[model samples]
Target: MRPLTAQDPDQLGRYRLLAQIGRGGMGQVLLGQGPDGRLVAVKQIHRQFTGNPEFQARFRREVLASQQVTGAYTAGVVDHDAESATPWLASEYIAGPALQDMIAEYGKLTVSGLKLLATGLAMALLEIHRTGLVHRDLKPSNVLLTNDGPRVIDFGIARALEDDLALTQTGTVLGSPAYMSPEQAECRPLTAASDVFAVGAILAMAATGASPFEAASTPQVLYNVLYTAADTSAVPPPLRPIVEACLAKDPAARPTPEQLLDLAGRIEAEPVWPVRIRRHIADCHAEAMAWADGTARSATPQAPAPPKKRWQRLVPIAAGVSVLTLVAIAITGIGQEGTAVAMDDPPLALTDDETRGLDVCALMKPDVLGELGTAVGELVPGGVTGCRVYYLDQSGQKIYFGLETSIPVGETRSGNQPMGTTINWMPVLGRYREALSCDRSVVTQSGLPLALTMTATPNAGNGCPAAERALAAVVRRLAVNPPLRADAPDSVLRMDACTLIDIAATSAVVGDPVRERTPHGCAATGRDGYFAVDIDDRVRPDNVVGGKVRPTTTIAGREVYVHHEAETYCEFIVMIRPTRDDRAEQVHTTYYSTLPDPPDTCDTAAGLLAPALAKLPTS
Candidate 1:
């Protein structure tokens, strides 16, 4: 980003321009701050184009359509002024480099990185196409990469710039010819599939550091795009097939964005982007944060964190529930209010430290449900400290069996005590029925609080019987030495997320931060903002937490995915390692600030994660 120039306006609409982020044939993209204290990328059109009747009409229509394009991967249009003297559009300001810039500076992406890039581009296309618009110019430069994923930009105004044949200006085309499809190159009526074609070229470039249709001159490049068969030999074997299919001369031969999404799913690899690319993203984020802090544009070094402290896991503020709690709440209309637990509340039979290594999945024996039901899929990690299994009942209906170890056990003053029961001499808390669900809890011989839940499908009948049977089996197994999780000695689960970052580190963002403990993580609130750390096993950060995925940046020597929520919150997830069930053992750090802009909540989240991550096991 650069300082504003003499020609740039100090303010536009309700935004105050901060810096010139970029400039192209159409106009300039300025980093602007909205009245609500949100950052936006404001695109101001060239004065010359605003007066053109064709440009004005197309701009207005596309702007309206673009407003409807909302998805995880595309930067949705936030504000636009097509009728203004100098029409401009603003979008969520994404803090990362374009694919073109990334590839140019860092060389080609790894095969794994290419697959991630392909998936994000395909998803972005799906969103744009879903809204009845084609990203006419899907090129490396138009694709922005963030920690979460790729975001397609300029969907509306960019297309508006492609009016008459003169817009292409064969002699000086506005868009990159190398990334254009044959139909777009020939100026024929286009379809969403045309963007798919561009995705293919982009993949080829991202994989080989040069577009498949590259040439010495603009005209030559256009000729190659129109007539040449893309050379995918240099592309990685795994991605060549998809790239070839995308580069097919006939737009119809190209795979749909949905098809690409399916293909991308099969490329199962963690730490999505290449290591160097992740570092580059972190560098960009650091620079952006520096600018946000009103510091001069320069490389800012990540400061060393303070001494680590031994943090004990705190009890949940309220008695925690199983993952099935959400389903029950939806069905029973149970409210979360008046659920807080007091410090003097009854203690769990066992503490988290006593059961941290015990795998809840191990205690759930499939044969225990013999004749009554059969375990469906393999035992999978359910929550931060839990596991669950889906069993098919005799009636062919599926029942969910979830077991969470080391959660806070307590009763509210509103008579919310557990129903007394005994299984194999173990104190069992049972039969907390909620519509189609049966809930149970037990304090193990070691004194850890264990909660079990069984949720049945519609008309599946009472689940408490099977729930009790399963709990009985689990309780029985707990009597013997239970199977321990094959976690690395340095596993993140062994660390207390709440205490990961010392109070000093957390207080840097939110003054005098106070801890707000949860089942598997910790959150701190202060006068200025709130920050948190959560650990879990999941495929993607966005899947567990809803947010717009951004670029992957480096934190504490680990690659972490970044996400934003409502422009006020930011989260960074660090993937520790892949587990037995093909899920990631990841740690998530989040920040929410009331300070305007807050110097990028991402910076705060990264700072919070840095200390915690540095102390995690690396095996």
Candidate 2:
């Protein structure tokens, strides 16, 4: 949670606003304390919509429907005020990360964890459907994972905004495209089964670490949802049948909430989540409690202006770093345009040739952090090349830094007013300020952005200075003779994904293309089709269960698997070699098009993969 900004109200209705949990397209979710010291998440609609009577009516209906949903797996509506100038609804504030954040931070949930989530979600949906309302936007973000169980939030709210939020040009519905059911994608009248479809998608994500209908663009995802069979092959056997039944395109064929409960059976009483997730929940709860007790500062105090010469960056005092204030920074909502800091220095760009193979998990050692007066804790691995280090500073304040590699700087952010400055001579390509954290990324010679994020306890001051110092230390190390990955030359992590395939030849298969690239992947867009190439460690096609068998063939002495999703998309995966864990390091090339008759899209996917296989390292 973040401190309440000056522009925000100190109190709303009978509750006092303590901090902001998050903000979205509609309004903000504020952490509020009631008269009895109970905490609640207050949802305030954007003030601009106050004058719309239709919107007001819809909000009233939403409040009524939400209040009717009372169940163990759902956050109950504790209070509401629909007649207020800017209406608000206060529900039980769940002090845990969203399912989306959990999956993105930690890897896929374990089998037992998946069962817990499935049972809780099914129970929540049953309660929602019992109230004669459907959770139209039942995606991963709306589900909060707590120690007790998963609690569904924002229930019955999406149906109220459907008409106004639909994307007409793209033929997309109001809900998230990846989780939307076939009927929902087509904008047909939704029943309770639509929520079941979303549950299946969420379970798939929890089991496989990717959505069943994931795609580069929103339209492509919608098309896949409407026309393609969901890929539940990666799901474990125990829950595979349940997921498949729930994802059936025909709503009538989908199982009811009661049936899902029966299928899930009794959830084990022992720990449902892994150790990492439990630790995160404990930290979040402690922070929220600190905010409620007024022990934590609401916002970082502004630092005084620096001298006219070189702008000396002031680091935070968390780890006994210099105590001077940092260069003046105006805090604003992330992605919102703010005053840009003007600097005379040229944009900072570091050489990535030597650092390209640096192992993210080994980049920052615990001993190095301990020397800086920090008690480094567990190192949690995230994506393919990301690591999160959780630790406490000199003052015993909780903090975590997420380090990610090989991300395209363009996709991070560009021309952002607030993030236009430099940090420790590094060009700040992106800046994301949350209630109690700050994130910054810098550009590298390879054009892939290196991300270093610092999140502090609610009471702690600005963490940017400490974050900057850490990044500077990393930069200094990389500039010298830093150790690279000791893994084999053929390891996917050591190779540049773009270099494996012929871009010019692949572009011809689609059309003359405009391209955007990632550190380990290549993507191109044509008038009619979108094409991409990626390398990753995953289960071989033959091992994956419950889906239509992927046709396999040999290309250049490497095993190749062809998987098609209706006429919307096609993909071919070339298996390079098996990892120590029995997972295959594979190259995946895909083609997607929304055109009436996509020309040889699968052929294009195969065309790229076949040549890319020849370039794979034999060692």
Candidate 3:
């Protein structure tokens, strides 16, 4: 049978594929419209899995177990076909990103967020266990966070209590090692208690970034799971005991799913918990809304009109006509012909005194500052220009300090004056100053040039200056190298240190900065100056001579400014345009290597990068 691709047949029996949602080790999941146009998730197994009768039986048992489980917290399976050429299963379609993706995009969940997740997941396991099924895989990726609540997914590896064949063969183990229970890791008979332990591990991961038995390798992680106790120092006090008990090496020590649910319910009933969780959700919504608003505002060029009452709509309509007429007059470059609109409360500009009094660096604590600096340093290492650290207290206020340094511009040569360097104090402090409508600048040192400016607008409440000071002190300390660092590695050394002044100045407009993705190539004269190439070939063992041949080659070029679009594991579309330049110069080229059997949905970049390379003009 041919491998499934994006354009392959969509309707599988009664299900209509709407889109490919996600893929995993065992199968591909498609977002489909089922009977009565109800949205459902369809999981299609790979051919290899179908070839094994034991695997098919396991899959059938999972389907049976899923059918038995019913609850708002669990994604109940609606249909399945284990006897089909490529087995498939369908379940209720839950709308939301996976917990893993959400946390990766927006740090660890707050205490309230963690509590809500814990409660929802605990409730889910209660339903699963009631059906006598054990969800062997309960990692972050399997949990979906919807607006209504969390939903558990992926029952491909679930084991039913009555199934004698559920245990792995010989010395092999099933489920993710990071979240596996001690009994599960040791190949002992599984029970509902295993799911409870997995839930605790998931909650701990949500609360803290790390897992209880985090390790560099699978074997080591499994060893930690079966032999050692989890480190709970990083876990918050409220959740420490709960997660620690669940992760206890002995199965009997773990709480039942029902007990966990009760604990989560109690946490949810706390007076302050709801408010904090709501605020976190609100923040997420606001960020998303801001991004949408910005995109809409940029896409449309029209300016918004002032509001008018319904009764006075005609009058405002006439006024709008006059405004457009005036705009036309201004466009003609006859400025005096346009009417002068009256200003509503002339804007009050910030005086120099207010700017100097605005100390934004006091909002962050020393630990947060240190973590921020360390994270940035690790991200770029040799390429980092500067790093700033800051935080806001319970009351929203900025406190920060920064260290600036210059990265070597290009490869170094012996005896050559090291390439020119540039430096600036961390932007965190500067951003706060800017937020307070103040002017700030940095002086150059060690041949590293620097320049910066900031202004800030006060929110409704009074800002915290002590936090700002503490943040600044931390930044300054980080700006200097630790003692006995003369022979330290280049990575250990701080590039530069200096004190700067914040000058008082009139308030200025501080707009959000523009963010751009890495550009592949530049264009000139409206034609392609460079193009990308992609090659796909199979890997061979070192002993094999010309063992594998290239499978395919895709050569593509696009006119400059054309939008690039791609979808993973399926298909990609490249926009092309007629070359305008008479020379017919190819300015840019891109290449993509396709997956042999891409799931209905997959990441486009991962599928494209291996077989792809690009070329650009030297100039």
Candidate 4:
């Protein structure tokens, strides 16, 4: 209902934010990076539910249920702090976008895609049932199509068969009206069959762009779902029978997950299925690529492109190079310190003329692009140019890397702009280069590289000073270190143990040198304390700004304030004192992206902030 603004990184639990991926009635879903640097999705419950014990119980149940169903087809719950004042849950992040989005952007899946989706969904349902839980919400948005396969997510409203109704009162409706089974609609006892029926609804939607039951209002939709038959005519001829059987109002008549898998296998056996799916994924990838490219405004699906001539020799080369190059970039540049440091081994050589030809387009490739160009060309009307990869050689070593295409000049949105710096710190080729390198010591609390500058001008306009200030804030926050020993002058503080009070106190005594109006926030932590400060006054829409603001409070007797107004920028300053009181003192400072206001979802900022915070000494 509301946009997710950013928040203090320390406010969130272990999960670090990456981006605001999606939002729904339940809350905002943020893509986060975990301790292992693996991607995760964190769903924070709306603040309105923070005080509701019933909601908390339900959240706990959802976490439990999701944990029970961790398997191949399901997005597993990785970490959770349900008892926290503001509850949040994290799950392994599936790389691809949602099924609903894919369909809306590139049209419904072809026959083979339908089968893959159906098979995956059925297996997910089987896992959910095995755990004695029902994923009351089984919609297209909850199913994600990753490179590996389809992954089912969002068990926020899942209900266990044996558990008491902890969150919902007797009369409230729980599941999505469009996908709810008859039993779910009537609030009757539900079995795994309920999920089967819901999966059937999902399959129907996937095969055709519309739900089996269509109505303008919730009451109308519920009536259609419970009392009327689905219009199977829209479903492909080969898949109609299976969808119809699954949509049967009677739970007993619905096919089991195993049965659905069998049906999917049968459908896959159809001669047209493989071709249809290949084209569908290719199209979905294309549309996504187009969206990523800023070329397509609308997500409407276009007709599939004609088959291209197979380049037998090019296939293996493309696969190997793409995978190896991306892996190398992500692993090397994502969180490394210093400048572009050379690896012990020499860089892989690009032998093919085509690979060398890629250098013409230097900035279009992203570090981890996968089958995007091919997918986009097939699904969308116009063909997409190749994707580009960008990286900072923070290892202090120079390397040459080629781009697939030349960087577009000026401010046109034709190509996906590489964020941060354009001068490749890690060059595609040529002599050892340092001009393009970002100061590698700059890192978030969680150790991921922070975006030091804007890659492209956003619709909101380019705020270069703001971007530069944000970058400086990150540098300042990370540069501060604590004293090595208790007897050491307070000035020589350990960076990890330093707190806002320490910084402020130090500033008050030594004179604060850095006073830039940074567009981002500042984060620092040390063994004795931790602090997060926003340098800019950018209050997100969801934040409590203006009059409703509260005063600073003391955590462990250390003063903290979420300052909405400051000469340089609106900032939130939190300080915690050391508990040990008698050890060799040291301080650690870690900085990250600017913190957004609440409800705006500061997952990415938080992700960058947490590891640094964790590194801080906690006496």
Q: Which parts of model 4 are misplaced by more than 4 Å?
A: 1-11, 24-26, 164-169, 268-619
- Badly placed stretches (over 4 Å) of model 3 are 1-7, 164-172, 268-619
In model 2, the number of clashes is: 1
Better of 1 and 3 by TM-score: 1
lDDT of 3 by residue, 1-619 (tens): 0123443347776887654454323445665666686666677775645776666776776677678777887777777787999888877765555665455545577767777788888888888888777877677767766656677876656767666233443333346556767766666667888888888887777776666776533345567777787787888877777888788777888888788877776663332223433444455444333332344223344465343322111111110000000000000001112111101110011222221122222212233243222221221111122334444434444434343222121211111231111111122222232233332322221112222221212333323233233333332322221111121132111211111000010001011211111111111111111112211111211112356422322333421221233332222222121222221112222322233443323133223322222322211
lDDT of 4 at 580: 35
Summarize candidate 4's per-residue lDDT along 1-619 as a digit string, tens digits. Answer: 0123434232256655544554322345665565666656666765545676665666776777778887798877778888876678877755555676565546677886787788888888888888878777676666777655677876656777765243223434346556778766666656788888888888888777777775633345567877898998888987889899888899999899899988888874442333433455565455434433445444455577443212111111111000001001011111112111111111112212222122212222221111111111221100011222223232322222221111212111222232332111211121111224222111121121122222211123332322232233222211211001122232222121222334553243224323221112233433322234331111232234565745653334333344443322333343323223222222222222222332222222233334334443342
Worst 10 residues of 4 by lDDT: 320-329
lDDT of every model, 2 decimals: 0.62, 0.63, 0.44, 0.46
Residue 254 C-alpha lDDT in model 2: 94
lDDT of 2 at 433: 46
- Lowest-sum lDDT 10-residue window in model 2: 316-325
TM-score of each: 0.45, 0.49, 0.44, 0.45
- Minimum summed lDDT over a 10-residue window in model 3 is located at 321-330
User: Which residue runs does candidate 1 get wrong by more than 4 Å?
Assistant: 157-175, 297-619
Top candidate on TM-score is 2
- Give the TM-score comparing model 3 with the true structure, all chains together: 0.44
Candidate number with greatest lDDT:
2
